[model samples]
Target: MSVRSGDKKTKILNPITIEKDFGGPIGAAFLTIFLPLTTIFLHLCCNEKYLAQGLSLEFNKVKDLFYDEVIVNFKENFFNERIWLVYCSWFFILVFLDFILPGKHLKGVELRDGTKLSYKINGLAMMGLLASTLIARFIQTNGEMPELSFIYDNILSLLCTSIFFSILLSCFVYICSYLPLMMSKNGINTNERILAAGGNSGNVIFDWFMGRELNPRILTWDIKLYCELRPGMLLWLLINISCLHKHYIETGGKLNQSLLLVNLLQGFYIVDGVLNEEGCLSMIDITTDGFGFMLAFGDLTWVPFTYSLQSRYLVLNPIQIGWLNFSLIILLNILGYYVFHSSNSQKANFRKDPASFNQMKSIKTKTGTLLLCDGWWKLSQHINYFGDWIMSWSWCLPTGFNTPLTYFYVIYFGFLLLHRQKRDEDKCRKKYGESWKEYERKVPYKIIPYIY
Candidate 1:
């Protein structure tokens, strides 16, 4: 990767010399093993059968990790053909929708080579079409919904299938990144296949985990962007709905308040994401990160399975929240959303057109980029992250502290956001130098207001 500085282009060499993030190669290898296992472990702990057995999420139960029955069950159900077919079909359907859907063709940020990639802004439309189809099916069935409960019933198998495919996709992209570029009649442009910064560490395990290509594309279809929102995020909503449907059926047409809230809140988040799909183009994942195992596993498997933990927990252990608590949770989410949305909007707007924020207090970086010192940006350097963390708490709060497992999302998300914030800070410190220190001094806090 190369950064354009004035008329000079600074070239970054392949195979980064020094490695630190993700604990270098050894840490990457450990995570490669640990992340998938963690996902599977969480699923096993929170599954209907395990919860029905009156087991607590205590450390003593760790011994059951290698129980004969558990191992046998996993081995038997881990590779179901039906589940694989369903998973693959859903993925392909999303791909097909991405191709045929109509929306504005927005251009992405210019690359080092001054090339702009066009992306379709049809995620919301695709979501609507899918929802309409599902609704139609429900209507056609005379008010009887399709077997969405199947998703919950076969959750383990689905997770396994997704993991398998994530690894497969990661391998495919990693190998493709190394292949020599084919020369076009117009001549070869090496910039068309740029490696991700820090992705080429000369360690296969680390590189594979971190991702090789900055933006791996097959023709015009961006694999990373497609995976970012389409399959994993939409599937998360689908899983919540499935769990909700299961609860509804098992309770004889009654819905649990906590389950309902989880569904509504998470569904809203997913809808908001789909509607604002264009915003993803500027996110760190799309602009900076490579398409590798870290992202693939997170997008394909970890998100849908682990994010729906609260709903999954409520399925077997329904927790009833009082109206007062429910209203408080809703209010909390509203506040969080306000902070998240407004802060992100301010930053995006400033990035797109700094002139619009001329009246806003700002500091210009050495690279000619302006940082706002007013509005939400004034509160904290990563005020948006604070908002996002707040919302994550609301998602888990409805679970009512029965098991620490249910609260995993909030805790894990807090750490994840902190790690991401640190990454952004490091990158900014390097890019902006003393200007970043000035921005930090002005903002004071990193994520929370009046706190560290």
Candidate 2:
């Protein structure tokens, strides 16, 4: 019931209440199959060869989804050992950086046992070192980048590798969750293993999909936190940069404005994510959700592959943008970034030291937590989501209106943010009860101002 930490004992909550999320077992099963297939389908749909043969969402072009050349290429390249080696090497390098990197060890939110886990905040440094190594290699080769297009060429294989790794990791952690506490000698504290509230449904499929262990770790290396940012986020930026280089080489050193915008905006987003990595410690993924198949696949495969679709799209369809359009998109992203960053900072600061935000109005709940009600929080319950959605458009708008496929990121991100907001509201309502209702009364809009 309690664990000793320092001079005091911390009480641990018991029998975490099981709550069926994502429509329970059937939905989990559906998503487990549907998501990966969707990623593959989207990749095929956006394939250069398929697009060259008039790939569109039209009924007649639907058959193009099964284009012979594309299918053959994917099948042939799906199991490239070289690609797998590069992907695995990248992962292990990140792990090495995580272990050896010097950083401020920030304590994460207290767990059910009322003990905090220390996390190394060195993502920015890691990014810098990786970028420096890459740049040094580029300089050494006189800017003759090592077949950067190989990434684009072997993308399918890379994706398969990530998906396989995610599945393998999920299985490993799930099995380890069943190990005895004596396994702590091997650096796993099975006694501290707790089933996720939404994942302990007694159904293996759903549990695996949703993640069985709440905080599966090896010694001090928190697997969930490490994966959340290191591999996927960095890989996303790397892919975007590689796409830019691919475009450069293919276009004979001519830079596409649209591609540049996509790279710059997304680069900024990724850089910000890495620099402010500590902000994610309190997010739902790290604080609540288990490191399951959903997160594993999302972090490894979905994020790097799907989120970089615009950059990948522009590699084949390099659309030119006017100065007017470019300026507007930049302004839009700046606005979005401002709101997203400031609001998050306010919330984080408020959570850490509510008294520091004395000027900002907040509603105190019976649960002894303060819900911010002023500043950006007054505009919407999830103003950060609104900002994030706004920025998603900037990433897509540069691809032009030639095909709806390029806009998939914005569309999918919008839905994902909306779902996340709804989930957050539901959880807060259940946690705070009438106080949440009061907070809602003070801040009516869910995400957008004067809108939904």
Candidate 3:
């Protein structure tokens, strides 16, 4: 519903939450559009050329640099057939596969209305299908595959396209929620609209950013699930593979150790995500948050386009990682994935049925859910977040002592998880009251081990 600040001073992310009330409601609305657009613009601005130009500019020269690059070169990269085709094809393929594939039907947690939404789980199958399709294409072409180079060549074009799609989808979903009754035939009219826990504070900017509704559905389609797991996650892997292919071509078809290590670790991470697809249903983003601009932009644009930066960086500038470092990196990734996956599975399994893991001990509270103060949960209140931090760093380290640009995910993700952990703790406190305090006392650390 809303991100947690330091304490329980929960501010609804509306227009009034702005630092200055220059234009009032208009200011809030402007911010809702301005912030995300600026981030996207800056990301485009930080392209290889722009960054180089930035370093070479003086006070007055900066304006000239911006005019030439931002206004001139940016427009050139913003539009390309390769970018458009790849972006469109990627979206179409993922959605179509999700539609036609067979999956196991499962029920989510019961909502306040006493009904559980059913979801079809088939992400792992989809991954296999994608890999097989690519392999088939490679084989049919007699070991030659050129399509993968498109992403490397048209990174900016793809980025602009992704931003366009994100804005389009966010607006479409907002409209769907805004006029659901009118949009929904048979006049299944309702007086009150369903809003998320901390959303719908009557601030247009805040509501637009945070989203107003929880579990928005169109017939059997759950919009949140579709965005959260299906498209962008796979798209991220596809981008990495493209980077790998392009690197291979440039490096005389010989992939270096650093790039290979990054590719392998990320591939494992994605495979883990796909294999444990059901676990995602229990996460906060799925059961709690609404489908809004924040999530829409994040899932559609930021994830696929930005998250694979390390691999993208390594494509043009190949870094040689020694075998020792490669092995160490692999071990670190495995450790992180092991802890992250185990903690998530333990908690999910505990919630599904406490007896699922016989060795796993938990404290059963009065409200009925068990507090897992054993195993990974004993290490920290949010041990999985620590694991995520470890893996994010591992993903970046392969780039070596390079520009700070490659390490952006590590910095950004750390803050994200910090806020997420605090938010989850706040949610638990509200849900379980005194019992949550007891659980916190039992597991003192928030994220890291003993130190934090």
Candidate achieving the largest TM-score: 1
Per-model TM-score on C-alpha atoms: 0.94, 0.92, 0.84
User: What's the C-alpha lDDT at position 239 in model 1?
Assistant: 90
Off by over 4 Å in 1: 1-10, 13-17, 52-60, 65-70, 183-192
Kindly indicate the candidate among 2 and 3 with the higher lDDT.
2
- Candidate 1 has a TM-score of 0.94
Model 1: which ten-residue window has the lowest total lDDT?
183-192
lDDT of 2 by residue, 28-98 (tens): 88998889877776777677766622235665465555455345666554666777788888898889889
The whole-model lDDT of each prediction reads 0.83, 0.82, 0.71
Ranking by TM-score: 1, 2, 3
Model 2 pairs in collision: none
Best by lDDT: 1
- Which pairs clash inside model 3? 13-206
Higher-lDDT candidate of 1 and 2: 1
